[model samples]
Target: MKKVILLSMVTLAMISCNKETQAVEKVKTAYIDTSKLLEENNEAKDIEEKYKVKSEEMGRELRAEASRFQNEAASFQQNAMAKGQAWAQAKGAELQKREQELGMKQQAMLQTLQQESGKEMDSLVKRIKDYVKDYGKKNGYDYIYGTGDAATVLYAKEAYDITTTISKELNDKYKGSEKKEEAPKEEAKK
Candidate 1:
C-alpha cells in the first residue's frame, strides 16, 4: 500500500509539471518598434503636416510684422537728425517698445505652439497605447513590448515584431475615418 501511494504521488507531480510547462509555452508575446510605428502611422503623419502648416503660417505673419517694424526703424534712422533730439528720443523709445512687444509676441506664439503640439502628441500616444492594449487582448497576446528610442525590450525575434502589422492597421483605420468625415461634408454640401 505504501509503495502504491508513493508511485501515485510521483506520477501526479510529473503531470502537474508538464501542464505548467505547456501553459508557459502557450503565452503569446510581441514587440513593436515605437519609432517605426510613429513614422509609418498615417494619423501621426497628418498631425505632423498639420503642425508644419500652422507653424509656417504663424512664421509668415510674424515675419510680415517684423518687416513692417524694420521699415519703420529704417525710416526713423533716415529722419532722426532732421526730426531733432527730442523727437528722435521719443521715436527711439517708441521703437524700443515696439521691439519688446514683438519679442513678447514671438515668445508667446512659440510657447502656445509648443503646448498645443505637446498636447496633441500626448493624445496621439495615448490613443496608440490604447489601440495596442485592445489589440493584445483581442489577439491573445500575453505581453507586447516596445522597442525604439526609450526601448523596453533589448532584443526580440523578427517574427515577434508586429510594428508593420500595427502600422498598416492604424493607417487603414485612419483612412476609413477620413472617408467617413468627408462623407458628412459631402452630404452637407448637397
Candidate 2:
C-alpha cells in the first residue's frame, strides 16, 4: 500500500513538471519580405550602380574595338586587289586571327564582369543572412520566415510580419556606415 502511494506521488510530480515545461515553451515566429529588403538596401543599390557603370564602360570599349576592326577590314579589302593574291591571303589570315582574339577577349571581359557581379551579390546575401541570424538570436525568435512573390511563407498574421522592422534596422545600419565613410572625407577636406 505504501509502494502504491509513493508511485502515485511520483507520477503526479512528473505530470506537474511536464505541465510547467509546456507553459514555459513559447514559439515566436516572424516573417520578412526578402525582395523588399534587397530593394530597400542602400548598399545593394550602390553595388548595382557600380556594376551598371562598369558594364557600360566595357560595352563602349568593345564597340570601339569592333569599329577599329571594321575599319581595318575595309582598308584590307580596298588594298587586296592591288596587293596580289598571296599577300592578300596572308593579310586575311592575320585579320582572322585578330578577329578570333577579339572574340575571346570580349568573352573574357563578359565572364569577368559576371563573376564580379555574382561575387558581390553573394557577399551581400551572406551579410544579410548573418544580420538576420543575429537579429533572430537577439530577439529570441524561434523562426523567421522569408516571403515574397516566391512566398516561402504563404500566410502569416500581420502582427507577425517583421519586414518593416528589419528593413528599417538594415537601412539605419547602412546609413550609419555611410556617415562614417563620409566623416573621414569631410575631415580630410578640412
Candidate 3:
C-alpha cells in the first residue's frame, strides 16, 4: 500500500513538472517587414533595378539581332532559291540548317545569362533571411513571421510587435556608424 502511494506521488510530481515546463515555454509570434528587409538589404533593390535595366537592354539587343538575322535570312532565302536553280538544292538546305544551329546557340547563351541573374536574386534573398533571423534572436523574439501580399497583421497584440524596437536599433546603429565616418570629414572642413 505504501509503495502504491509513493508511485502515485511520483506520477503527480512528473505531471506537475511537465505542466510547469509548458507554462514556462515562451509564446512567440513573428512577422516580416518586407519593406524594412528590402531597405536593409539595399542590394536587393539594386539588383531589381539593374535587372530591369539589363532586361530592357537585352530586349533591345534581341530586337536588333532579330532584324539583322531576318535580313540575313532573307538574303539566304534568295540565294538558296537561286542556288537551287544554279546548283544542287541540297547545298541551300545545308546553309539554312547551319543558321538554325547558330540561332540555338545564341538562345542558349541568353538563357544562361538570365539564369545567372536569378542566382544573384536568390543570394540576396538568403542574406535577407539571415538578417531577419539575427534581428529576431537579438531582440528576444520567440517567433517571427513573414508579411505577404495580404497582410494578416490586421490586429496583432501590441506585445507581438518587436519591429519598432528592432527598427530603431538598426537605424540608430547605422546612423551612429555614419556619424563616426563623417566626423573626420566635418573636422577636416573646420
Candidate 4:
C-alpha cells in the first residue's frame, strides 16, 4: 500500500508538470516589409503625388523668375553699352543683386518643399506604426518586426510577412475616412 501511494503521488506530480508545459502559449510574431507597405499604401501614394505636384508648381515658378531675370539681364546688357560707365557699373551691380536674390529664392523654395515633404512623410510613418501597434494588439501578436532599407528583420518566412495585410487594412481605413470627409462637404453644400 505504501509503495502504491508513493508511486501514485509521483505520477500525479509528473502529470501536473506535463499539463503546465502544455498550457504555455506560443508567442505570435510577424514581420512587415516596410518598403512594400509604403509603396503599396494608397495614402502614401497620394502623399507622393501631392508632393510631386507641389514640386512641379514650385519648379515652374522658379523657371518663370529665372526667365524674367534673364530678360532683365539681357535688357541691361543692351542698354549698358549706350549708357555712361557709371550707370553701367550701377546697373551691373543691380543685376548681380537680382541674380543672387533669385538663387536664394530657388534655394528657399527647395528647402521649403523638402521640409514639407519630410513632415508629411514622417506623419504618415507615425500613423502606419500606430496602426501596426493597434493591429498587433487586436490580433494577439506578441511581436511585429519591420524589414526594409534599414531592416530590423534579416530573415523571415514569407508566411510571417504582414505587410500586404496591413497595407490593405490601412488603405481601407483611409478610403473610409475619405468618404466620411466627402460626406461632410456634400452635406455643407446642401
lDDT of 3 at 61: 68
- How high a TM-score does candidate 4 get? 0.84
Tens digits of lDDT, candidate 3, 152-190: 565666566555555555556556866898999999999
Note the Cα lDDT for every prediction shown: 0.95, 0.92, 0.69, 0.92
* Candidate 1: tens digits of C-alpha lDDT, residues 43-65: 88888898889988998999999
Model 1 misses residue 14 by how many Å? Answer: 8.1
Candidate 4 per-residue lDDT, tens place, 1-190, comes to: 9999999999999999988886664778899999999999898899889989999998998899899989989998899889979999998999899899999998998899889989999999999999999999999999999999979988998989989899999999999999999999999999
Q: Order the candidates by lDDT, highest first — what do you get?
A: 1, 4, 2, 3
Worst 10 residues of 1 by lDDT: 42-51
- Cα deviation at 88, candidate 3, in Å, is 8.4
**Best candidate (score: lDDT):** 1
Off by over 4 Å in 1: 1-21
Q: How many clashing pairs in candidate 1?
A: 0
Which one wins by lDDT: 1 or 3? 1
TM-score of 1: 0.87
lDDT of candidate 3 at residue 47, scale 0 to 100: 71
Q: Which ten residues in a row have the lowest lDDT in candidate 3?
A: 34-43
